[model samples]
Target: MYISAFPTFSFSKLIKRKKAQVFSDYFGYENTRFFYRGAYAIFYGVKALGLKPKDTVLVPAYHCGIEINAILKAGINVKFYDVTHELEVDIESIKSNIDEHTKAVFVIHYYGFPQEMVSLNKLCQTHGLKVIEDCAHGLFSFYKSKSLGAWGDISVFSFQKSLPTADGGAIVFNDRKEDCFITQKKPALLTTLRAYLLLYSEHIHMFKGFLFSVFNTLILKPSRFILKILKRGGSKVITANTNEFDAQYVSLGPSGITEKLIDSIDAHGIVVNRRRNYQHLLEGTKHIKNIKLLFNNLPVGVCPLFFPIRVNQRDLMQQYLSDHGIETFIFGKKLHNLLPKEQCPVAWAYSDELLCLPIHQDMNPGNIEYILKVLEDENCPLN
Candidate 1:
């Protein structure tokens, strides 16, 4: 009865979903570049902006750190802007931070929620700053009847974040001048193998079965040593953290396997199921006292990645669920160290209080019921 925080690569869905158009083909092969990881995509996109040295890109104060690392690695300065406690981009904070050296504003669609794209575009246009849409959490997210990644000057997406890919990322230049282009190479074999193995190990721990138990006892327990020795994200089936950005990986493109999976995924089914599961949690959690949902409404044209909530005892609640064979993880709990917490206390405090419950494509109504029962039994806020 174990449930995973991350979506599993389901063979069942693979059978139903036929191979379709590839990323490069859909986005146009000429301007799209793939990468081994999302951070590398960020780096490549930042470099493609044709920004000069000493140019500053304004980013949110609350972030997972990798985006800033990628931007800095591209030989650019970064200035942190405030994000309101509600997780919306603060436009005034952005305005206050913009200056002559500010060349771009990197907007993240946090946890599949859309930002104020129209207003942000207007401001960026007036200030002459490029908009880089970081859609790492926003593959299926949409606003105003339009998809998220296409709203900016250029965009980046991470398939591993939304889909059950071994690893993948892509950078799309809305319009790239000839001088701004760079050729990308395929990823190394070791890099491809490591991510797929992690995906396999994640699948092994996802559900309860006699065969999975035997495999865990015989193979995984002994191989657990080797698995740990292999540098990776949370091998416990919830991979929320990512490795820091590397300069060498900037030239590495997505693997063939990742590209294939992207074309094979059930795009419509994934979006529908996830939205349904999210509504179940939303309606079901109302009676659960002392717990607060991050966003009260599931806006139209938006697909949520996770059900985020703020509770007083977030760690304790996370552990309680883990003990029950249900895994949940926090997002952005560890902010980029360079961001001064004192400058934006609301964002920092918001980070510490936040946790994301699973609402991935694979989950069902029964799983939602089980999760709701667990929250009620333990009285989640336990403050």
Candidate 2:
């Protein structure tokens, strides 16, 4: 079976409850503010803080474009900061970009690799800028003993991305005090409907993975119009581009389901399995010439979302892997280009060469060996 970089959920217990009941049991809550998704969490965070329009916010040039939209939706101007070759934000560029108008800095922990938060926090303090850590990709990740989300003045985590939740986001404030904004009572009906639908979708996907892949690759590939419509409707809200910030806030339900799921995952040793698979990939491909592994160690504390490799022939290697049923990803393909050609030169270079390879919980040592062998046979310069 082909491995996916995305996280999976096991919902056998969730499937037993009525969708409405599940929503009420899991989503509705007091003492917590909610939004449609993470982007809205960001939107509300900025609004709740009462940031004025035209205030400048510094963001990594190479990031999910939706982040730009989120900042814009909050009526703030965004400035781009360059990223290092390792994909972390360039500290110097961040320092250079700071000015009186700079009110906040949003940092993305790319691919679950925690950025140098200590330095970033110091930088923010020096400039009197508030920090918003976008933990959409770095949920549950830590920097030293501190959590990534905890470092920022305000932080947001996308439960949809890291957790198995259908759609949810949470905002943590620096002072841990609740501030006033447009708030709402939890939507029990919607929460229940979404949870059950997500649970059902998982089962359907597992049972018909091959069929779905065929339909998506073959049937959906040629139908750009249909795909566009589907894309617009299918949680496009999560992407930074879709701006529906003015929409009403709805509770993502609560932490009961997420806590249970996390407990179950721990009980089943999924984290260990994920780490072991990551280690297998790292060990298997350590000597691949012209391909540099971003980190020297098996990434710990922050579970790697994918095993990323920077290769000279990234596009070719990706095709080579795909042809052999070993899937790969080209994350942030147009990241730097989206900013400006000459603005972030190193980020542009890194974007072209980086390829994220599969290292999910589903893969085994045999799978890792097979992928390595295929690369070796293809004259992929395995040292």
Candidate 3:
């Protein structure tokens, strides 16, 4: 059988019921202002405030390009900030970069791990800057008493990223109400249906690597031509590299079926399982030299997206894991080289060393052992 970085949902009956209840209960938003995608929230938020071109928005250098594209799309300038060795935002860098032109700061709770929001919030408050928390990896995860998305002037969550939803997103405001955009809601039905069908298709069995390779080569790759044709009408299509900001503009709140799937996810249980898997990986790798674990907290309030380990032979280690049926990832490969040399020295230095291992809810002890055995083998050479 193939092992993947994440698991496919069986779409059980109970999960469907819970999805709606949890969304209604947890996300208490009325029909104030809704959009099809999360990017529209950003667009509307900035547009409603009458923000103009040349205004700067601070963002972490270690973030997806979609966010930058969104800011750029709004005709706003983007300034990059550094992330700490712990993979949290470098607040000092943010402080140094803020100026009269800096209107907002976009912070991401990377890999479902909470950033030091308490401190970041205080800094933003003192600087009189608006905060936009990117909760793409942080849905259902909390920082302290409040959820990550709740801490900002405006927050965005990617249903496509964390939830079982095939495609959609939510943009929420804490204090200010945004003007409504004429969102095309019906068009999303086809995309969502396609995603759901793919989720349950027989092709899902090869999720380990072969499936991704096949999907990328066979379907996903060729779809660009079709998307180009659709784009002529000013419509955008979702792709693996779809920008975060653009996603926001088009993504809407979860659909009925997606809500049901998310509800069945056992959010609490998923966190518990992930924490257990994290502990197992930590315990198993404690004796391994030249490898550093990013998290300082053993059981962080943040639900981990994956267990990141920094090792010397990162590429070789990734290959080894994949060759043995254990999937690995370079979480922020695109982000490292984008920033200035001096801004994120630590992140850049360690970027090549970082490798994310599979630690999703479906992973178990046997899978963990198989991963560890490969790492512990003395014959495994560095590079």
Best by lDDT: 1
Instruction: Give the Cα RMSD of candidate 3.
Output: 4.7
C-alpha RMSD of each candidate structure in angstroms: 3.7, 6.3, 4.7
- Deviation from native of the Cα of residue 283 in model 3, angstroms: 1.8
Q: What pairs collide in candidate 2? A: 23-192, 27-253, 27-254, 66-240
Candidate 3 structure quality by residue, lDDT tens digits, 1-383: 45566545445533443344434445575523434445555555665556688888898877656666766777888899888877788887888898889988888887788888888889888888888888777876777767677788877776555444555556777756645654545335445545565654322543345466666667764665665676687765443224445444343444556555645556666677777887888888776664578764564576777788777778888887777767676756566234677767766666667788877766777878877777777755442
Model 2 lDDT on a 0 to 1 scale: 0.65
**Model 1 spans > 4 angstroms off:** 11-30, 177-183, 221-241, 379-383
Tell me which of candidates 1 and 2 scores higher on TM-score: 1
CA lDDT, candidate 2, residue 324: 72
- For 1-383, candidate 2 gives per-residue lDDT tens digits of 44444444556633433323311222223323544467777877777666899898898887656667767777888889988877788999988988888998989898778999998899888888899888877665667867667788888766655445555666777645757655344435434344534444443454457576565565545554554665577633222123334344432333355534433433123345566777887777766654578766755676666777878888888877776767676666766234877888777776787788866555567767877787668455333
**TM-score per candidate:** 0.90, 0.75, 0.80
Alpha-carbon local distance difference test for all models: 0.79, 0.65, 0.66
Best by TM-score: 1
Better of 2 and 3 by TM-score: 3
Write candidate 1's Cα lDDT for 265-284 as tens digits: 76777789889989999999
